[model samples]
Target chain A: MTPSKQEILSVAAECFMEQGYHATSIDDVARRLGATKGRVYHHYASKIDLFFDVHREGMARLFAAVEPARETEGDGATVLAAMLYAHALAVLENHTFESVVAQGVQMHRFGATTPGQRSTLDELIASRDHFEALFKNQAAIAKKDGSLADVDISIAVKTMLGGVQWSLIWYRPNVDSSARTRANLAKQMVRTLIDGVRTRAALQQDKPERRPSRAK
Target chain B: MTPSKQEILSVAAECFMEQGYHATSIDDVARRLGATKGRVYHHYASKIDLFFDVHREGMARLFAAVEPARETEGDGATVLAAMLYAHALAVLENHTFESVVAQGVQMHRFGATTPGQRSTLDELIASRDHFEALFKNQAAIAKKDGSLADVDISIAVKTMLGGVQWSLIWYRPNVDSSARTRANLAKQMVRTLIDGVRTRAALQQDKPERRPSRAK
Candidate 1:
């Protein structure tokens, strides 16, 4: 809750995101803050506690932002639009956290041994499940109302999550293509999901401007 | 190649796939092979080299299988069918290599810092470009002949590649889904490429599945 602790957590999240958990050390976190290890130790019991805070904070912010849209009285499509727009902004705001969580997924598949690493992993997974829970409930509601197509929420969740998480690898927030510009691509994603890029109706007559189709 | 070296590469690939690159030590591979570190180090200069060999071998096998598909005389859709089928099998066969390569992509972005890692990255990128080259050419031919829908080959390549590569993270050979099941899925993928999933006619339909006009 202290000002110095908040500042340290912010820098530590950046280092962890860029360097990874195994490669990172608490000393590096302290060094980035121009502080001593003793100072960090004073604020936090251990590195694991700091990592948990980062994971928890990241998830809490995302869920809080999307919760309003999820609770709004609108069609499923509108709710999805609101949720995705919020996701895009969150991804843009915390680029490092998004990338770090992705690395955490790989680390999770192979369990980490250190108490710090394991605790971080558990918190990360719990956050992910919570995020997915929102989407799953919305998906169920939409499906029941026929605003969403019939599809397995599990597979669809992975695909949707894949698009969002994986895009972070390629998404460059340049001055020309600002976070908002990259976020505009969300429309295309929404179009692809609701109407489907290869929707049966869309393919009946080849649109002349459609990009080169790869069949073979 | 000597049989021992080839065997070592194969075992290393499996170990890396199952346990991940950072988690799976050279000792683990040796143990899996029922050999000692002496034998492994004798063959591979380092763990990175061993992993690179596995990546190269897996990629070569993938391209070799798809060569027939690329050269086959058929419409774009048919050629794509062959390409998809070949990729699906190779994917299941090289699941471990596939996963390691996936992790390698992340590691490369972070701080891989080794000759073998760089070389493997180059080779993998080149092989993917080569595969895309074949698909693009076939797509052109299909479009010229009116056999396929219009699409962006560049984006299509990303989607198909991402779709297949991402599957490695979740695919389990022990599952009830057989190769035949995937083969059908691949075929459907090909079909969707030629015909968009939603079609214009479907969008224009005025009624639900059972609703009929009274013509009053």
Candidate 2:
């Protein structure tokens, strides 16, 4: 069966994440989709184009998750936590896309520029910076409200991102790891990151009535 | 002048990280070292051997950082902080090797099996688990002492690692970002991770006398 463009992009992302970009081909993605090269090419002009689209889609999903939280009428901690939880869930749900995006992001500095490279690279950077800016702004607010620890904004942002983004590499869909279970786990993970920035006074004021017990 | 085997390994790691494993050739490494392929082969049987050595060196550096903290006489919090600080410094100081190791680690499950694949894979997994276990043990101890938050150890450990390991991608040596500056930044980053897992009661009792002021 000829797969849809979306299907082709999804399969291509998984292939890119599984095998490095230089090693993967449009044929590999087509074969994974049970389609032909012509079908894959009908949508994406080239492998590079397809990879760029996958990256754009991943960024879009992340922005979709956090953008709403950015507009929410809540405290900085609440906003940051909401955005983080959404971002984590997005990463868990779209592991292949997220992983491919992450790999592309790191390799962005290394890859040789091709036709249309500059524009795409700039767009990618802008998308990423925009997403990160949300957290940075909230962190500023959190600090003003005296909810956050006296941590550098860059360190705080990167640390929070590292915790969530790394999930793409290690998290898997398991029998017992249901959607709800994963969501809760994501919340706990984000809590650790958010709490890292919480001031001592904030920590005292923001205790949850029900906390997960330590597994003995 | 012909470079030593140590220099070859170091240069090869940087190449592998910059150009990737498949795209990087042994000849490329030799050229980087102003040596011939024969000189490279004398120390490493092939590109695979060099890559493996790079990974081993990366793990050794990380273990070296954390192991001393484990032996020190300190509370769980102090020990965990020391280990994390050391780990972060190792990652920053050896960004190229750490980046290559991070790439290799994530790609290990995808690579084709070689003659000693099983044993090497087992060894890699064991080394990684052993390193992570130190954090887990400390978290367990911290819990027993009621100093840690009631979060899952697995989440806490991964969160902590994700923050530091991701630094390989974005961190750079700059004029203002001196060694002392980076060390202090690493400390702040670790504090966020450690604070995430610290109990509210512990948080109150453990406030540092000095805090980094918000960036103006």
Candidate 3:
């Protein structure tokens, strides 16, 4: 049976994440799928095309997860927290695709792409900027609403996003598997990021710190 | 004039960071130095060797910055914050080397290195693990002292380290130049990570949140 494009992309994303864009080839993707290079070629004209598609699909998944949270009725901090939670879960669940997205971002940043691929790279970067803007806007609102601490919104948002996104490099799914584990991990990540920016009063009510020893 | 090995590593690190290991050649590094490949080859046997050296230097710089803070007389929270601040500065100041370090970590993680280079890769990995252990031990102490929140020490440390390290990917020195900017950026990052884990009372006194209006 001929594998579908989505199947091909899934296998290709895994190969790319494992081997990297420069090292991964259509044959590698095909072999991983237990198929021939022709099978992959039928879906993707070239390796670069397949790579960009995986990147685009990864961004789409992130949007699907967080867009709802962005639209949900809540204060800025609440909305930002919801969006961050959704994003962390999406990253954990779609690890391979997100890794590709990260690779694509680096490729563009370092001018590793060919001239022909520049347009697609630009589109991907724009999507990333848009995604970042969502968090930035909400963070600004949260600051104005007095829910967040007096921090630089741009730096705070970037650092928070960076913490969540770096999961691609560090999170090993094989070691930490299970739906509960994933959810708990996402919750922990969200709490750290959101609480990092929450107002002192709000943070006090949210998760009170451990009691200090009198001796100390 | 014969360029020193340190000079070659710095140039090679810039080449590797900008163009990646596969695309960057010894000739490219030498050309960027306005010399011949012989200069680079004289100091290093192969491109992989140079790459590993850059990775080692990067790790060494990080240790130089953070190890002092580790030994300072202070509580865990104070120690961790100092270490993180020093780390952020190291990453920003040595952006090229740190970028190479990040690339090396990813390369090793994804099995991109050849069998010949595996031992060196293992050594680099060990160094990275040692660095993380410093943060983990201090976080444990902070938690015990009731200075930190009741979060998983491992997760919190990894996430905090991730946020600071991801600066290598997002920080642009050309755009945000000056010593003051770098120092301020590091301070902000340390505050977010440390405050995120600090007890509510501790955070409140350190940097009070903006007051909210009762009209809302």
In terms of lDDT, the best-performing candidate is: 3
DockQ of each: 0.16, 0.31, 0.29
* Candidates 2 and 3 compared by DockQ, better number: 2
List of clashing residue pairs for candidate 2: A149-A197
Error (Å) of candidate 3 at residue A165 is 1.2
Tens-digit lDDT track of model 3 for A15-83: 999887888899999988999899888888999999999999999999999999888666667778788
Off by over 4 Å in 3: A71-74, A112-114, A197-216, B71-74, B197-216
Error of 3 at A16 (Å): 1.5
TM-score of chain A of each: 0.80, 0.86, 0.89
**Candidate 2 wrong stretches, greater than 4 Å:** A71-73, A174-177, A197-216, B174-177, B196-216
Reference-based TM-score, model 3: 0.88
Superior candidate under TM-score, 1 versus 3 = 3
Q: Which model scores highest in DockQ?
A: 2
What is the Cα-based lDDT of residue A97 in candidate 3?
Answer: 98
Predicted candidate 1 versus true structure: per-residue lDDT over A25-100, tens digit per residue: 7899988888888888887887767766766667777777778778665666456646755775676566666666
| Model 1 chain A poorest 10 in a row by lDDT | A193-202
Model 1 misplaced stretches (Cα beyond 4 Å): A1-3, A71-78, A114-120, A173-177, A199-216, B1-3, B18-24, B61-93, B112-120, B129-160, B172-216
Order of quality (DockQ)? 2, 3, 1
| Cα RMSD for candidates in order | 7.5, 7.7, 6.6
